[model samples]
Target chain A: MKADQTLDCIGLYCPIPIVKIATKIKDLKTGEILEVVGDDKGIKLDVPAWCQATGHELLGIEEQGGEIKVYVKKAPN
Target chain B: MAKKEKLTIAVLSGDLERALAAFMLAVTGASMDMEVSMFFTFWGLNIVKKNEGTMKSKGLMKKMLNMMNRGGSKRLKLSRFNMLGLGTWMMKDLMKQANMPSIDEYIAMAKDMGVELIACTTTCGVMGISPEKDSFRSEVGSLAGAAYFLSEARKSGVTLFI
Candidate 1:
């Protein structure tokens, strides 16, 4: 999937990946998509949960070679 | 716009792992755009002390308690497998390799993210910890009673006691 920006959080653990995503998402325009790439298994659950809790949209998730990729769309306030 | 959700965490343990969990949750809650507050009481108060070693206090009992506990985030031992501090050292090494922030770093991150750190007044009194005397971390914004924590917890979507 195409994303407006990408954030690589490989080698980081839970909360760090999510924190990076949250911080990076702020730099994008509303509705712009952010692709978060990480190896932390926790993100598979955290990304969707965080997006759901914060009013963002989780577009999709992909996993290849043990790395997980999550796509989130910024929410309109 | 909707009001941000609130997250209140009570730090009740001085264990290194538990302290890490508390700060991790605090920072994550704040990163999720929630207003977060951490209430420190009893043994948990050690996590916010400015000093890591034997604290000066009046009376033999208070001095002994402070000396044994030595309240500080960096001085905390693990709840399990402490191995006379070896386990904690290993844990810290692993965390550093994994890019996990240290307890002090998490505290800094929480403060920068505007997470409120509140020290319990009752615990302060019982443990002879005086904020006015610089016993507590400067990041601690308030010294409050249980009523303050209860009110904050009542309004919070997530309230956890660690």
Candidate 2:
């Protein structure tokens, strides 16, 4: 999928990947899409929860080959 | 957008393991756009101690307590299995292998994310820790009492006492 930016946080654990994602999301323009890939055990829940709390739109979450991919659309500030 | 949820984390342990665990929650909460704060009380105040040593030889018991918390956060031990400080080392290694941010890094991020770090005035007094002379980090939001924490928690949707 097309994304304004792709953040590869694979191998990073909880809070780090999410933290990186949170920091990167701020750099995107409103309506820009962010694609994040992480293999942390908690990434599945963490990504969506982050989106919910930050008022962003979680367009999709996919899992393949034991990796998690999350698509987030930047919310208008 | 709906009003962001507010979270209050009460860190009541000085153990490295527990303190790191609680900070993980605080950092995550703050990143999620929540209004997050932590009340550092009792033994937990050790994490913010700038001075390594206090009145060590004042009394036998106080001396022992001072020895247990002689240094800053670096001297913190795991709540259990702290054999010759090996347990603390093991945990840090594990955190490293897991690619988790170090405890210090998490605390710094929480500060940057605007997480309020409050030291309990009563705890400091009871523990003979002077908030003024202790030289805690400047990130500390306030030296406050239970009443103040209670008021904040009353307005918080999520309150966690770790």
Candidate 3:
């Protein structure tokens, strides 16, 4: 597997962070992983819900030094 | 089979909160690479009107109503648009300074982003507004009825009535 692509979405509000991440993931090739970084408390649920709704795969989620990181893989349809 | 997922938002309220929320959702949906559509009907069409003024509040009760007008509600009874208030003017200026696009800008952005804007024909006819009138964009789809809007909503992965 290649190194995951990272998307920093900190400081943005609801929908904006999700929107930015979605836009970034669309340009990536299938099987490529995306690392989404954000601090929105809502994103902890919002991102996963969005990924599930849009058919994207959520690989993992972790917290490091107070920042939240979401791992997503572009799933093939 | 994996089906393409899209979102369609039906804006049926003309409240400021509803309009802003719908615009935000549309911008977000487009950014998400989802095909999004906004159906403007009833008072909701006011947001798209070129001549419409900003929402305003006068008394304490009215101010409370103004703050509550963010999201479209099926039966929300709020104060009318404030045509002569510093608050309304301030709100517009604040939105501009915040880098938030105006309703008109959002409509144009939606077009550029391939988001569909559908006007309700029934409402337009009742209000005596014509699509050919000045300031209305030709890119707006035909005035559709509730049935048509609902049909499109059924195909969308997420549908919002704002």
Candidate 4:
């Protein structure tokens, strides 16, 4: 999915990737999409769980080789 | 977004891994727009001590206890596979390689994220630790007993003991 901002979380582990995504999402405007790419296996689950918990919209996820890309839309204030 | 949720974590262990987990949860909860509070008691109080080695305590027993423990985040050992601190060193190196923040950095992040760090007053009194003696970290928000933590825990959406 195309996004307004791309955050690279390569090499980070669980919680850190989620933490970074949460922090980065704050910089984007409400309804803007954020594309997060990471190598951490936990990202696939963490991103969706984070979105579900925080009320953000998880657009989709794509996996290529060992890398994963997740798109999340910021929730309105 | 839903209403702001609350998370209360009781940090009861001083081990590196446990401390790391508590801080990780605290920061994540805060990032998710939750009000997070960490209650430090027993060995967990070590994580909030100033790393400076010069903290002095009165009385022979207090001095002995201080010398044996030398409480601080940097001196924490792993609960298992410590290998006399070698394993902890290796684990920290791996964490650094993964771009993970150290425990101290996590403390700073928690502070920046507005996570409350509350020291256990009961533990402090029992352990002969005087918070006013400049032993605890300045980031500590308040000194409260289990009653305060329990009240907060009762109101929290999620409460954990680590």
Task: Chain B TM-score per candidate, please.
Answer: 0.93, 0.87, 0.70, 0.94
Q: Each prediction's TM-score against the native?
A: 0.94, 0.91, 0.70, 0.95
lDDT of 3 by residue, A1-77 (tens): 23468888776557667767877887889989998888767778988888876778888888877688888889885
lDDT of 3 at B134: 35
Q: Which stretches of candidate 3 lie over 4 Å from their true place?
A: A1-3, B27-35, B51-109, B133-135, B154-158
lDDT of 1 by residue, B47-146 (tens): 9988644565677777777767777877889999899989989999999998999999999889988999998978876776654436787788888889
* Model 1 clashing residue pairs (backbone): none
User: lDDT per residue, candidate 2, B17-46, as tens digits?
Assistant: 888988888888888888898999988888
Q: How does model 2 score on DockQ?
A: 0.75
Candidate 2, clashing residue pairs?
none
DockQ value for model 1 = 0.85
Interface RMSD of every predicted model, in angstroms: 1.0, 1.6, 3.3, 1.7
Flag the better candidate by TM-score, 1 or 4: 4
Tens-place lDDT digits, model 3, residues B7-109? 8998877766567678788877876567888898767766655543323434565345434432222222234554554455566677676555665666666
Task: Judge candidate 1 at residue B107 and give its lDDT.
Answer: 93
- For residues A1-77, could you state the per-residue lDDT of candidate 1 as single tens digits? 99999999999999999888888888999999999999989999999999888899999999999999999999986
lDDT digits (tens) for residues A1-77 of candidate 2 = 78999999988888888778888999999999999988876888888888878889999988899888899999998
- The recovered share of true contacts, given per candidate in order, is 0.96, 0.85, 0.35, 0.85
Q: How many angstroms is residue B72 displaced in model 3 relative to the true structure, after the best TM-score fit? A: 17
Candidate 1 chain A minimal-lDDT segment of 10 residues: A17-26
Runs of candidate 2 exceeding 4 Å displacement? B51-68
- Stretches of candidate 4 off by over 4 Å are none
* lDDT at position B110, candidate 3: 69
Kindly indicate the candidate among 1 and 3 with the higher TM-score. 1
* Candidate 1 residue-wise lDDT at B21: 94
